[model samples]
Target chain A: MIEVRLFATLRQGREKSIMLDSKDFSTPGDILKHLDIIPGEVSILLVNGFHKTLDEKLEDGDVVALFPPVGGG
Target chain B: MERRYERNIPALSDQECRLLRSKRVAVIGCGGIGGYLIELLARIGVGYIRTVDGDVFEESNFNRQLLSEQPLMGRPKAKAAEARVQRINPRIEVEPVSAYLDKNTAAEIVSGCDLVLDGLDNIAARRILAAACSEAGVPYIHGAISGWVAQVGISMPGDGLIDILYPQGVSFRDRSVLSFAPSLCASVQAALAVKMLIGRPVETGTIYYFDLLNQEFETIRLDLGKKE
Candidate 1:
Protein backbone atom coordinates (compact mmCIF):
# COMPACT_ATOMS: atom_id res chain seq x y z
CA MET A 1 0.00 0.00 0.00
CA ILE A 2 1.02 3.60 -0.66
CA GLU A 3 0.04 6.67 1.27
CA VAL A 4 -1.19 9.71 -0.66
CA ARG A 5 -1.59 13.13 0.87
CA LEU A 6 -3.15 16.16 -0.72
CA PHE A 7 -2.72 19.80 0.10
CA ALA A 8 -4.90 22.87 -0.44
CA THR A 9 -7.35 22.47 -3.33
CA LEU A 10 -5.65 19.31 -4.46
CA ARG A 11 -7.72 17.45 -1.92
CA GLN A 12 -10.41 17.25 -4.62
CA GLY A 13 -13.00 18.07 -1.97
CA ARG A 14 -12.44 14.64 -0.56
CA GLU A 15 -10.56 13.20 2.40
CA LYS A 16 -6.99 14.38 2.71
CA SER A 17 -5.55 10.92 3.15
CA ILE A 18 -5.62 8.07 0.64
CA MET A 19 -4.17 4.59 0.39
CA LEU A 20 -3.77 2.76 -2.85
CA ASP A 21 -2.74 -0.74 -3.89
CA SER A 22 0.95 -0.32 -4.68
CA LYS A 23 1.03 -3.09 -7.27
CA ASP A 24 -1.37 -1.28 -9.59
CA PHE A 25 0.70 1.92 -9.80
CA SER A 26 4.31 2.26 -10.76
CA THR A 27 4.63 6.05 -10.33
CA PRO A 28 3.00 9.01 -8.66
CA GLY A 29 1.61 9.85 -12.06
CA ASP A 30 -0.04 6.46 -12.13
CA ILE A 31 -1.74 7.16 -8.83
CA LEU A 32 -2.89 10.52 -10.11
CA LYS A 33 -4.21 8.85 -13.22
CA HIS A 34 -5.96 6.23 -11.16
CA LEU A 35 -7.58 9.00 -9.19
CA ASP A 36 -8.39 10.92 -12.37
CA ILE A 37 -6.55 14.08 -11.34
CA ILE A 38 -6.66 16.50 -14.23
CA PRO A 39 -3.50 17.17 -16.10
CA GLY A 40 -1.62 20.25 -14.88
CA GLU A 41 -3.82 20.39 -11.80
CA VAL A 42 -0.90 19.43 -9.59
CA SER A 43 1.90 21.94 -9.42
CA ILE A 44 4.14 20.10 -6.97
CA LEU A 45 4.67 16.40 -6.39
CA LEU A 46 6.50 14.87 -3.45
CA VAL A 47 7.09 11.21 -2.95
CA ASN A 48 8.38 10.18 0.47
CA GLY A 49 9.12 13.83 1.33
CA PHE A 50 10.94 15.16 -1.76
CA HIS A 51 9.96 16.52 -5.12
CA LYS A 52 9.75 13.87 -7.82
CA THR A 53 8.43 13.79 -11.34
CA LEU A 54 5.13 12.15 -12.19
CA ASP A 55 7.00 9.68 -14.38
CA GLU A 56 9.32 8.64 -11.57
CA LYS A 57 8.57 5.06 -10.60
CA LEU A 58 7.09 4.45 -7.18
CA GLU A 59 7.63 1.38 -5.00
CA ASP A 60 5.54 -0.11 -2.26
CA GLY A 61 5.24 1.98 0.93
CA ASP A 62 6.09 5.10 -1.05
CA VAL A 63 4.25 8.15 0.24
CA VAL A 64 3.08 10.59 -2.41
CA ALA A 65 1.86 14.14 -1.91
CA LEU A 66 0.35 16.59 -4.35
CA PHE A 67 0.04 20.37 -4.28
CA PRO A 68 -1.62 22.76 -6.66
CA PRO A 69 -0.34 26.17 -7.55
CA VAL A 70 -1.65 28.59 -4.97
CA GLY A 71 -0.26 31.57 -6.82
CA GLY A 72 -1.97 34.88 -6.10
CA GLY A 73 -1.06 38.27 -4.62
CA MET B 1 18.98 56.75 11.10
CA GLU B 2 20.63 54.61 13.73
CA ARG B 3 18.66 56.22 16.53
CA ARG B 4 15.39 55.00 15.01
CA TYR B 5 16.65 51.49 15.41
CA GLU B 6 17.63 52.02 19.03
CA ARG B 7 14.39 50.55 20.23
CA ASN B 8 14.89 47.41 18.15
CA ILE B 9 17.78 46.45 20.47
CA PRO B 10 17.79 42.89 21.78
CA ALA B 11 15.43 41.69 19.07
CA LEU B 12 17.95 42.78 16.48
CA SER B 13 21.38 43.36 17.96
CA ASP B 14 23.41 46.39 16.98
CA GLN B 15 25.52 44.31 14.62
CA GLU B 16 22.42 42.77 13.09
CA CYS B 17 20.86 46.19 12.67
CA ARG B 18 24.05 47.38 11.05
CA LEU B 19 23.95 44.43 8.67
CA LEU B 20 20.39 45.18 7.72
CA ARG B 21 21.18 48.87 7.33
CA SER B 22 23.91 48.06 4.84
CA LYS B 23 21.74 45.71 2.79
CA ARG B 24 19.46 46.69 -0.11
CA VAL B 25 16.30 44.88 -1.17
CA ALA B 26 14.25 45.16 -4.33
CA VAL B 27 10.51 44.78 -4.00
CA ILE B 28 8.82 43.91 -7.32
CA GLY B 29 5.28 45.07 -6.61
CA CYS B 30 3.65 47.77 -4.49
CA GLY B 31 0.14 46.53 -4.14
CA GLY B 32 -1.04 44.79 -0.99
CA ILE B 33 1.99 42.66 -0.14
CA GLY B 34 4.62 45.10 -1.30
CA GLY B 35 3.08 47.98 0.64
CA TYR B 36 3.30 46.14 3.93
CA LEU B 37 6.70 44.65 3.09
CA ILE B 38 8.11 48.09 2.34
CA GLU B 39 6.80 49.47 5.59
CA LEU B 40 8.17 46.54 7.57
CA LEU B 41 11.63 46.84 6.04
CA ALA B 42 11.63 50.57 6.62
CA ARG B 43 10.66 50.26 10.23
CA ILE B 44 13.23 47.54 10.71
CA GLY B 45 15.91 49.93 9.42
CA VAL B 46 16.82 48.38 6.10
CA GLY B 47 18.79 51.28 4.69
CA TYR B 48 17.97 50.95 1.01
CA ILE B 49 14.92 49.71 -0.87
CA ARG B 50 14.11 49.58 -4.59
CA THR B 51 10.41 49.37 -5.40
CA VAL B 52 8.80 48.71 -8.79
CA ASP B 53 5.18 48.76 -9.88
CA GLY B 54 3.53 49.83 -13.13
CA ASP B 55 0.00 49.88 -11.83
CA VAL B 56 -2.04 52.78 -10.60
CA PHE B 57 -4.24 52.17 -7.62
CA GLU B 58 -7.75 51.20 -8.58
CA GLU B 59 -10.79 51.52 -6.40
CA SER B 60 -11.07 47.77 -6.47
CA ASN B 61 -7.76 47.52 -4.64
CA PHE B 62 -9.23 49.43 -1.74
CA ASN B 63 -10.60 46.22 -0.33
CA ARG B 64 -7.21 44.58 0.24
CA GLN B 65 -4.32 46.80 -0.79
CA LEU B 66 -2.85 48.72 2.14
CA LEU B 67 -1.61 51.54 -0.09
CA SER B 68 -4.97 51.92 -1.84
CA GLU B 69 -6.36 54.69 0.26
CA GLN B 70 -9.50 56.40 -1.01
CA PRO B 71 -7.58 59.59 -1.75
CA LEU B 72 -4.78 57.94 -3.73
CA MET B 73 -6.75 55.92 -6.26
CA GLY B 74 -5.20 57.33 -9.40
CA ARG B 75 -1.59 57.45 -8.19
CA PRO B 76 1.04 55.01 -9.36
CA LYS B 77 1.67 52.40 -6.70
CA ALA B 78 5.46 52.78 -6.88
CA LYS B 79 5.30 56.51 -6.32
CA ALA B 80 2.77 56.06 -3.60
CA ALA B 81 4.98 53.48 -1.91
CA GLU B 82 7.91 55.86 -2.06
CA ALA B 83 5.84 58.62 -0.54
CA ARG B 84 4.63 56.32 2.17
CA VAL B 85 8.14 55.07 2.88
CA GLN B 86 9.38 58.61 3.10
CA ARG B 87 6.69 59.44 5.57
CA ILE B 88 7.40 56.32 7.59
CA ASN B 89 11.17 56.60 7.65
CA PRO B 90 12.73 59.59 6.02
CA ARG B 91 16.27 58.35 6.52
CA ILE B 92 15.88 55.19 4.49
CA GLU B 93 16.89 55.24 0.83
CA VAL B 94 14.00 54.26 -1.43
CA GLU B 95 14.12 54.21 -5.23
CA PRO B 96 10.71 53.92 -6.78
CA VAL B 97 10.48 52.67 -10.36
CA SER B 98 7.02 53.25 -11.69
CA ALA B 99 7.26 50.62 -14.40
CA TYR B 100 6.51 46.99 -15.04
CA LEU B 101 9.21 44.27 -14.85
CA ASP B 102 9.67 42.10 -17.90
CA LYS B 103 12.53 40.07 -19.28
CA ASN B 104 13.86 43.22 -20.88
CA THR B 105 13.67 45.46 -17.81
CA ALA B 106 14.22 42.93 -15.01
CA ALA B 107 17.97 43.25 -15.24
CA GLU B 108 17.97 47.02 -14.86
CA ILE B 109 15.34 47.05 -12.13
CA VAL B 110 16.87 44.33 -9.99
CA SER B 111 20.42 45.60 -10.17
CA GLY B 112 22.33 46.50 -6.95
CA CYS B 113 20.00 44.46 -4.79
CA ASP B 114 21.07 42.14 -2.01
CA LEU B 115 17.84 40.19 -2.36
CA VAL B 116 14.61 40.44 -4.38
CA LEU B 117 11.08 40.02 -3.06
CA ASP B 118 8.22 38.92 -5.27
CA GLY B 119 4.80 40.45 -4.72
CA LEU B 120 3.50 39.61 -8.16
CA ASP B 121 -0.09 38.37 -8.37
CA ASN B 122 0.39 36.12 -11.36
CA ILE B 123 2.65 33.15 -12.03
CA ALA B 124 4.13 34.51 -15.27
CA ALA B 125 5.55 37.63 -13.67
CA ARG B 126 6.94 35.62 -10.80
CA ARG B 127 8.61 33.27 -13.27
CA ILE B 128 10.26 36.18 -15.00
CA LEU B 129 11.46 37.60 -11.71
CA ALA B 130 12.70 34.20 -10.58
CA ALA B 131 14.74 33.73 -13.74
CA ALA B 132 16.22 37.18 -13.35
CA CYS B 133 17.23 36.47 -9.79
CA SER B 134 18.72 33.13 -10.72
CA GLU B 135 20.73 34.77 -13.48
CA ALA B 136 21.97 37.41 -11.08
CA GLY B 137 22.76 34.65 -8.54
CA VAL B 138 20.74 36.51 -5.92
CA PRO B 139 18.26 34.86 -3.64
CA TYR B 140 14.59 35.29 -4.54
CA ILE B 141 11.92 35.40 -1.86
CA HIS B 142 8.52 34.31 -3.17
CA GLY B 143 5.12 34.80 -1.59
CA ALA B 144 1.69 34.38 -3.17
CA ILE B 145 -1.86 34.40 -1.90
CA SER B 146 -5.18 32.84 -2.82
CA GLY B 147 -8.01 33.97 -0.58
CA TRP B 148 -7.02 33.05 3.01
CA VAL B 149 -4.31 30.71 1.79
CA ALA B 150 -0.73 31.81 1.12
CA GLN B 151 2.58 30.21 0.12
CA VAL B 152 6.08 31.45 0.86
CA GLY B 153 9.41 30.10 -0.25
CA ILE B 154 13.07 30.91 -0.80
CA SER B 155 14.98 30.08 -3.97
CA MET B 156 18.66 30.74 -4.19
CA PRO B 157 20.79 29.99 -7.21
CA GLY B 158 20.21 26.44 -8.61
CA ASP B 159 17.06 25.74 -6.63
CA GLY B 160 14.73 25.88 -9.64
CA LEU B 161 11.81 25.92 -7.22
CA ILE B 162 10.01 28.50 -9.31
CA ASP B 163 9.50 26.08 -12.16
CA ILE B 164 8.03 23.61 -9.71
CA LEU B 165 5.87 26.19 -7.97
CA TYR B 166 4.54 27.50 -11.25
CA PRO B 167 4.06 24.92 -13.97
CA GLN B 168 3.42 25.79 -17.60
CA GLY B 169 0.79 28.38 -18.37
CA VAL B 170 -0.68 28.47 -14.89
CA SER B 171 -2.68 31.67 -15.17
CA PHE B 172 -3.68 32.95 -11.75
CA ARG B 173 -6.54 35.38 -11.90
CA ASP B 174 -6.50 38.67 -10.15
CA ARG B 175 -9.08 39.75 -7.52
CA SER B 176 -8.87 36.49 -5.58
CA VAL B 177 -6.61 37.76 -2.84
CA LEU B 178 -8.33 38.82 0.35
CA SER B 179 -7.06 41.73 2.43
CA PHE B 180 -5.47 39.37 4.94
CA ALA B 181 -3.61 37.22 2.46
CA PRO B 182 -1.06 39.75 1.24
CA SER B 183 -0.62 41.25 4.66
CA LEU B 184 0.15 37.82 6.10
CA CYS B 185 2.37 36.87 3.20
CA ALA B 186 4.31 40.11 3.42
CA SER B 187 4.94 39.63 7.08
CA VAL B 188 6.24 36.15 6.42
CA GLN B 189 8.38 37.34 3.52
CA ALA B 190 9.89 40.17 5.53
CA ALA B 191 10.71 37.90 8.46
CA LEU B 192 12.41 35.37 6.23
CA ALA B 193 14.37 38.08 4.42
CA VAL B 194 15.59 39.49 7.68
CA LYS B 195 16.62 36.02 8.72
CA MET B 196 18.51 35.51 5.48
CA LEU B 197 20.30 38.83 5.68
CA ILE B 198 21.34 38.47 9.32
CA GLY B 199 23.28 35.27 8.55
CA ARG B 200 20.70 32.93 9.95
CA PRO B 201 20.16 30.20 7.40
CA VAL B 202 16.72 30.25 5.86
CA GLU B 203 15.16 26.94 4.93
CA THR B 204 15.92 27.58 1.32
CA GLY B 205 14.05 25.35 -1.13
CA THR B 206 11.17 24.88 1.27
CA ILE B 207 7.63 26.15 0.83
CA TYR B 208 5.64 27.30 3.86
CA TYR B 209 1.91 26.98 3.65
CA PHE B 210 -0.31 29.21 5.76
CA ASP B 211 -3.99 28.53 6.13
CA LEU B 212 -5.70 31.47 7.82
CA LEU B 213 -9.08 29.82 7.88
CA ASN B 214 -8.00 26.83 9.93
CA GLN B 215 -4.89 28.49 11.33
CA GLU B 216 -2.73 25.52 10.43
CA PHE B 217 0.76 25.69 8.97
CA GLU B 218 2.82 23.08 7.13
CA THR B 219 6.11 22.99 5.32
CA ILE B 220 6.86 21.25 2.06
CA ARG B 221 10.57 20.51 1.78
CA LEU B 222 11.80 20.46 -1.79
CA ASP B 223 15.41 19.32 -1.40
CA LEU B 224 15.87 15.68 -0.48
CA GLY B 225 19.69 15.54 -0.69
CA LYS B 226 19.33 12.07 -2.19
CA LYS B 227 17.17 10.32 -4.71
CA GLU B 228 14.35 8.28 -3.21
Candidate 2:
Protein backbone atom coordinates (compact mmCIF):
# COMPACT_ATOMS: atom_id res chain seq x y z
CA MET A 1 0.00 0.00 0.00
CA ILE A 2 1.14 3.50 -0.73
CA GLU A 3 0.09 6.42 1.44
CA VAL A 4 -0.66 9.73 -0.20
CA ARG A 5 -0.63 13.03 1.72
CA LEU A 6 -1.84 16.40 0.57
CA PHE A 7 -0.99 19.81 1.96
CA ALA A 8 -2.22 23.41 1.65
CA THR A 9 -4.70 24.06 -1.12
CA LEU A 10 -4.13 20.58 -2.41
CA ARG A 11 -6.25 19.31 0.47
CA GLN A 12 -9.31 21.25 -0.51
CA GLY A 13 -12.16 18.84 -1.22
CA ARG A 14 -9.74 15.93 -1.04
CA GLU A 15 -8.79 13.46 1.63
CA LYS A 16 -5.60 14.51 3.36
CA SER A 17 -4.26 11.02 2.91
CA ILE A 18 -5.42 7.93 1.14
CA MET A 19 -4.07 4.42 0.93
CA LEU A 20 -3.71 2.89 -2.49
CA ASP A 21 -2.45 -0.46 -3.65
CA SER A 22 1.18 0.01 -4.65
CA LYS A 23 0.84 -2.50 -7.48
CA ASP A 24 -2.02 -0.48 -8.91
CA PHE A 25 0.16 2.60 -9.47
CA SER A 26 3.69 2.82 -10.87
CA THR A 27 4.63 6.44 -10.27
CA PRO A 28 3.57 9.54 -8.38
CA GLY A 29 2.11 10.87 -11.61
CA ASP A 30 -0.25 7.93 -11.73
CA ILE A 31 -1.43 8.71 -8.23
CA LEU A 32 -1.99 12.33 -9.19
CA LYS A 33 -3.87 11.22 -12.25
CA HIS A 34 -5.97 8.80 -10.21
CA LEU A 35 -6.65 11.58 -7.75
CA ASP A 36 -7.75 13.79 -10.69
CA ILE A 37 -5.10 16.41 -10.06
CA ILE A 38 -3.34 18.03 -12.97
CA PRO A 39 0.42 17.65 -12.95
CA GLY A 40 0.84 21.40 -13.37
CA GLU A 41 -1.30 21.97 -10.29
CA VAL A 42 1.32 20.35 -8.09
CA SER A 43 4.44 22.34 -7.24
CA ILE A 44 6.20 19.91 -4.95
CA LEU A 45 6.08 16.15 -5.03
CA LEU A 46 7.81 14.12 -2.33
CA VAL A 47 8.16 10.38 -2.02
CA ASN A 48 9.17 8.86 1.29
CA GLY A 49 9.82 12.37 2.63
CA PHE A 50 12.26 13.52 -0.05
CA HIS A 51 11.78 15.54 -3.22
CA LYS A 52 10.99 13.32 -6.18
CA THR A 53 9.96 13.87 -9.76
CA LEU A 54 6.59 12.75 -11.08
CA ASP A 55 8.04 9.75 -12.93
CA GLU A 56 9.92 8.31 -9.94
CA LYS A 57 9.03 4.69 -9.29
CA LEU A 58 6.67 4.04 -6.43
CA GLU A 59 7.40 1.35 -3.87
CA ASP A 60 5.18 -0.47 -1.47
CA GLY A 61 4.67 1.33 1.87
CA ASP A 62 6.18 4.51 0.41
CA VAL A 63 4.52 7.69 1.59
CA VAL A 64 3.87 10.27 -1.12
CA ALA A 65 3.00 13.90 -0.36
CA LEU A 66 1.78 16.54 -2.79
CA PHE A 67 1.80 20.29 -2.31
CA PRO A 68 0.43 23.09 -4.44
CA PRO A 69 2.35 26.26 -5.06
CA VAL A 70 1.68 28.45 -2.05
CA GLY A 71 4.12 31.19 -2.93
CA GLY A 72 3.03 34.44 -1.28
CA GLY A 73 4.55 36.87 1.16
CA MET B 1 19.30 45.42 29.26
CA GLU B 2 17.50 48.34 27.72
CA ARG B 3 13.91 48.78 28.81
CA ARG B 4 12.69 48.60 25.22
CA TYR B 5 13.82 44.99 24.93
CA GLU B 6 13.31 44.06 28.57
CA ARG B 7 10.57 41.62 27.71
CA ASN B 8 12.78 40.03 25.10
CA ILE B 9 14.86 38.55 27.99
CA PRO B 10 15.43 36.14 29.74
CA ALA B 11 13.92 34.59 26.60
CA LEU B 12 17.08 35.99 25.02
CA SER B 13 20.23 36.21 27.07
CA ASP B 14 22.04 39.49 27.63
CA GLN B 15 24.79 38.38 25.27
CA GLU B 16 22.24 37.35 22.66
CA CYS B 17 20.48 40.67 22.94
CA ARG B 18 23.72 42.49 22.38
CA LEU B 19 24.58 40.17 19.52
CA LEU B 20 21.32 40.91 17.77
CA ARG B 21 22.13 44.57 17.85
CA SER B 22 25.30 43.98 15.85
CA LYS B 23 23.83 41.87 13.06
CA ARG B 24 22.77 43.12 9.62
CA VAL B 25 19.91 41.46 7.75
CA ALA B 26 18.31 41.96 4.37
CA VAL B 27 14.56 41.53 4.07
CA ILE B 28 13.40 41.05 0.47
CA GLY B 29 9.89 42.28 -0.34
CA CYS B 30 8.17 44.70 2.00
CA GLY B 31 4.52 43.83 1.64
CA GLY B 32 3.09 41.12 3.84
CA ILE B 33 5.82 39.01 5.44
CA GLY B 34 8.46 41.68 4.99
CA GLY B 35 6.49 44.29 6.92
CA TYR B 36 6.14 42.14 9.98
CA LEU B 37 9.72 40.91 9.73
CA ILE B 38 10.98 44.47 9.70
CA GLU B 39 8.81 45.39 12.65
CA LEU B 40 9.80 42.37 14.71
CA LEU B 41 13.49 42.72 13.94
CA ALA B 42 13.46 46.40 14.76
CA ARG B 43 11.69 45.86 18.05
CA ILE B 44 14.09 43.04 18.84
CA GLY B 45 16.96 45.52 18.44
CA VAL B 46 18.49 44.27 15.21
CA GLY B 47 20.84 47.17 14.56
CA TYR B 48 20.85 47.24 10.77
CA ILE B 49 18.20 46.30 8.21
CA ARG B 50 18.17 46.71 4.43
CA THR B 51 14.68 46.50 2.94
CA VAL B 52 14.37 45.70 -0.79
CA ASP B 53 11.16 46.03 -2.79
CA GLY B 54 10.08 47.90 -5.88
CA ASP B 55 6.34 47.64 -5.43
CA VAL B 56 4.08 50.11 -3.78
CA PHE B 57 1.22 49.42 -1.45
CA GLU B 58 -2.24 49.41 -2.99
CA GLU B 59 -5.78 48.90 -1.79
CA SER B 60 -5.47 45.21 -2.50
CA ASN B 61 -2.61 44.81 -0.03
CA PHE B 62 -4.57 46.33 2.83
CA ASN B 63 -6.11 42.97 3.59
CA ARG B 64 -2.81 41.26 4.44
CA GLN B 65 0.08 43.73 4.39
CA LEU B 66 0.99 45.26 7.73
CA LEU B 67 2.44 48.47 6.35
CA SER B 68 -0.43 49.07 3.98
CA GLU B 69 -2.27 51.87 5.60
CA GLN B 70 -5.09 53.72 3.83
CA PRO B 71 -3.11 56.92 3.85
CA LEU B 72 -0.04 55.28 2.34
CA MET B 73 -1.76 53.43 -0.50
CA GLY B 74 0.54 54.65 -3.23
CA ARG B 75 3.70 54.74 -1.08
CA PRO B 76 6.58 52.41 -1.77
CA LYS B 77 6.53 49.35 0.50
CA ALA B 78 10.29 49.36 1.19
CA LYS B 79 10.11 52.94 2.33
CA ALA B 80 7.15 52.12 4.47
CA ALA B 81 9.10 49.32 6.08
CA GLU B 82 11.99 51.68 6.79
CA ALA B 83 9.67 54.24 8.30
CA ARG B 84 7.91 51.66 10.40
CA VAL B 85 11.21 50.30 11.69
CA GLN B 86 12.45 53.76 12.64
CA ARG B 87 9.20 54.39 14.45
CA ILE B 88 9.48 51.09 16.29
CA ASN B 89 13.10 51.59 17.31
CA PRO B 90 14.76 54.90 16.66
CA ARG B 91 18.22 53.47 17.24
CA ILE B 92 17.94 50.91 14.44
CA GLU B 93 19.31 51.89 11.05
CA VAL B 94 17.25 50.95 8.00
CA GLU B 95 18.07 51.25 4.31
CA PRO B 96 15.17 51.05 1.88
CA VAL B 97 15.96 49.91 -1.66
CA SER B 98 12.94 50.74 -3.73
CA ALA B 99 13.82 48.31 -6.49
CA TYR B 100 12.85 44.78 -7.41
CA LEU B 101 15.59 42.20 -7.09
CA ASP B 102 16.70 40.67 -10.38
CA LYS B 103 19.62 38.50 -11.47
CA ASN B 104 21.85 41.47 -12.06
CA THR B 105 21.05 43.11 -8.69
CA ALA B 106 20.46 40.04 -6.54
CA ALA B 107 24.13 39.42 -5.72
CA GLU B 108 24.80 43.01 -4.77
CA ILE B 109 21.66 43.14 -2.64
CA VAL B 110 22.67 40.12 -0.57
CA SER B 111 26.36 40.97 -0.34
CA GLY B 112 27.68 42.29 2.97
CA CYS B 113 24.62 41.02 4.82
CA ASP B 114 24.92 38.64 7.73
CA LEU B 115 21.63 36.98 6.85
CA VAL B 116 18.79 37.30 4.33
CA LEU B 117 15.09 36.81 4.92
CA ASP B 118 12.61 35.94 2.15
CA GLY B 119 9.37 37.88 2.03
CA LEU B 120 8.97 37.39 -1.68
CA ASP B 121 5.63 36.33 -3.22
CA ASN B 122 6.86 34.58 -6.33
CA ILE B 123 8.98 31.48 -6.93
CA ALA B 124 11.21 33.16 -9.51
CA ALA B 125 12.31 35.96 -7.16
CA ARG B 126 12.70 33.55 -4.27
CA ARG B 127 15.01 31.34 -6.33
CA ILE B 128 17.13 34.29 -7.38
CA LEU B 129 17.45 35.57 -3.81
CA ALA B 130 18.25 32.14 -2.44
CA ALA B 131 20.94 31.59 -5.07
CA ALA B 132 22.45 34.97 -4.38
CA CYS B 133 22.51 34.28 -0.66
CA SER B 134 24.03 30.88 -1.23
CA GLU B 135 26.71 32.37 -3.46
CA ALA B 136 27.50 34.94 -0.79
CA GLY B 137 27.71 32.22 1.88
CA VAL B 138 24.84 33.71 3.85
CA PRO B 139 22.10 31.78 5.56
CA TYR B 140 18.55 32.46 4.30
CA ILE B 141 15.29 32.15 6.18
CA HIS B 142 12.32 31.66 3.84
CA GLY B 143 8.71 32.48 4.68
CA ALA B 144 5.75 32.17 2.32
CA ILE B 145 2.01 32.13 2.82
CA SER B 146 -1.27 31.38 1.05
CA GLY B 147 -4.56 31.68 2.84
CA TRP B 148 -4.12 30.18 6.32
CA VAL B 149 -1.16 28.04 5.33
CA ALA B 150 2.49 29.10 5.62
CA GLN B 151 5.89 27.49 5.11
CA VAL B 152 9.06 28.61 6.84
CA GLY B 153 12.49 27.20 6.37
CA ILE B 154 16.17 27.93 6.79
CA SER B 155 18.62 27.21 4.02
CA MET B 156 22.29 27.32 4.80
CA PRO B 157 24.72 28.19 2.06
CA GLY B 158 24.96 25.48 -0.64
CA ASP B 159 21.83 23.74 0.62
CA GLY B 160 19.82 24.34 -2.58
CA LEU B 161 16.81 24.23 -0.35
CA ILE B 162 14.61 26.51 -2.42
CA ASP B 163 15.15 24.46 -5.55
CA ILE B 164 14.19 21.30 -3.73
CA LEU B 165 10.87 22.75 -2.65
CA TYR B 166 10.06 24.89 -5.68
CA PRO B 167 11.43 23.45 -8.89
CA GLN B 168 12.00 25.79 -11.77
CA GLY B 169 9.11 26.57 -14.16
CA VAL B 170 6.52 25.80 -11.51
CA SER B 171 4.13 28.68 -11.72
CA PHE B 172 0.71 29.14 -10.25
CA ARG B 173 -1.83 31.85 -9.86
CA ASP B 174 -1.60 33.90 -6.65
CA ARG B 175 -3.84 32.48 -4.01
CA SER B 176 -5.85 34.54 -1.59
CA VAL B 177 -4.04 35.26 1.67
CA LEU B 178 -5.87 36.13 4.84
CA SER B 179 -4.65 38.82 7.19
CA PHE B 180 -3.20 36.44 9.77
CA ALA B 181 -1.19 34.15 7.51
CA PRO B 182 1.78 36.39 6.84
CA SER B 183 1.69 37.68 10.42
CA LEU B 184 1.99 34.18 11.83
CA CYS B 185 4.59 33.13 9.27
CA ALA B 186 6.66 36.26 9.75
CA SER B 187 6.61 35.77 13.50
CA VAL B 188 7.93 32.26 13.04
CA GLN B 189 10.66 33.52 10.71
CA ALA B 190 11.53 36.28 13.19
CA ALA B 191 12.06 33.75 15.98
CA LEU B 192 14.23 31.66 13.71
CA ALA B 193 16.20 34.67 12.56
CA VAL B 194 16.92 35.73 16.12
CA LYS B 195 17.99 32.23 16.98
CA MET B 196 20.33 32.10 13.99
CA LEU B 197 21.76 35.57 14.64
CA ILE B 198 22.76 34.69 18.22
CA GLY B 199 24.94 31.82 16.97
CA ARG B 200 22.48 29.16 18.03
CA PRO B 201 22.63 25.88 16.15
CA VAL B 202 19.64 26.38 13.86
CA GLU B 203 18.60 23.50 11.66
CA THR B 204 18.94 23.78 7.92
CA GLY B 205 17.27 21.93 5.01
CA THR B 206 14.00 21.63 6.91
CA ILE B 207 10.64 23.21 6.17
CA TYR B 208 7.98 23.93 8.78
CA TYR B 209 4.47 23.90 7.39
CA PHE B 210 1.64 25.50 9.29
CA ASP B 211 -2.02 24.82 8.57
CA LEU B 212 -3.69 27.42 10.70
CA LEU B 213 -7.16 26.36 9.65
CA ASN B 214 -6.69 22.88 11.02
CA GLN B 215 -4.24 23.93 13.72
CA GLU B 216 -1.72 21.53 12.30
CA PHE B 217 2.03 22.16 12.21
CA GLU B 218 4.64 19.77 10.90
CA THR B 219 8.35 19.89 10.11
CA ILE B 220 9.75 17.99 7.18
CA ARG B 221 13.44 17.38 6.70
CA LEU B 222 14.58 17.76 3.12
CA ASP B 223 17.15 15.09 2.27
CA LEU B 224 18.75 16.59 -0.80
CA GLY B 225 20.76 13.43 -1.37
CA LYS B 226 17.48 11.59 -1.93
CA LYS B 227 16.34 13.94 -4.66
CA GLU B 228 15.29 11.92 -7.71
**lDDT of all predictions:** 0.84, 0.88
Fnat values, one per model, are: 0.68, 0.70
Model 2: residue B52 alpha-carbon error in angstroms? 1.1
What lDDT, from 0 to 1, does candidate 2 have?
Answer: 0.88
True lDDT of residue A66, candidate 1: 81
Give the CAPRI rating of model 1.
medium
Can you write out model 2's per-residue Cα lDDT over B1-228, one digit (the tens) per residue?
A: 898888988988989999999999999999899989998899889999999999998899989898899999898999988889888887898999999999999998998899999999988899899889989999999999988889999988888788877776566665789999999999999999999999887887788889888888878878754555
Q: State which candidate has the highest TM-score.
A: 2
Best by lDDT: 2
Task: For residues B177-196, write the lDDT of model 1, one tens digit per residue.
Answer: 77888989999999999999
When summed lDDT is taken over every stretch of 10 residues in candidate 2 chain B, the lowest stretch is: B165-174
lDDT of 1 by residue, A28-58 (tens): 8788887788647787788888788878888
lDDT of 2 at B60: 92
The Cα error of candidate 2 at residue B87, in Å, is 1.2
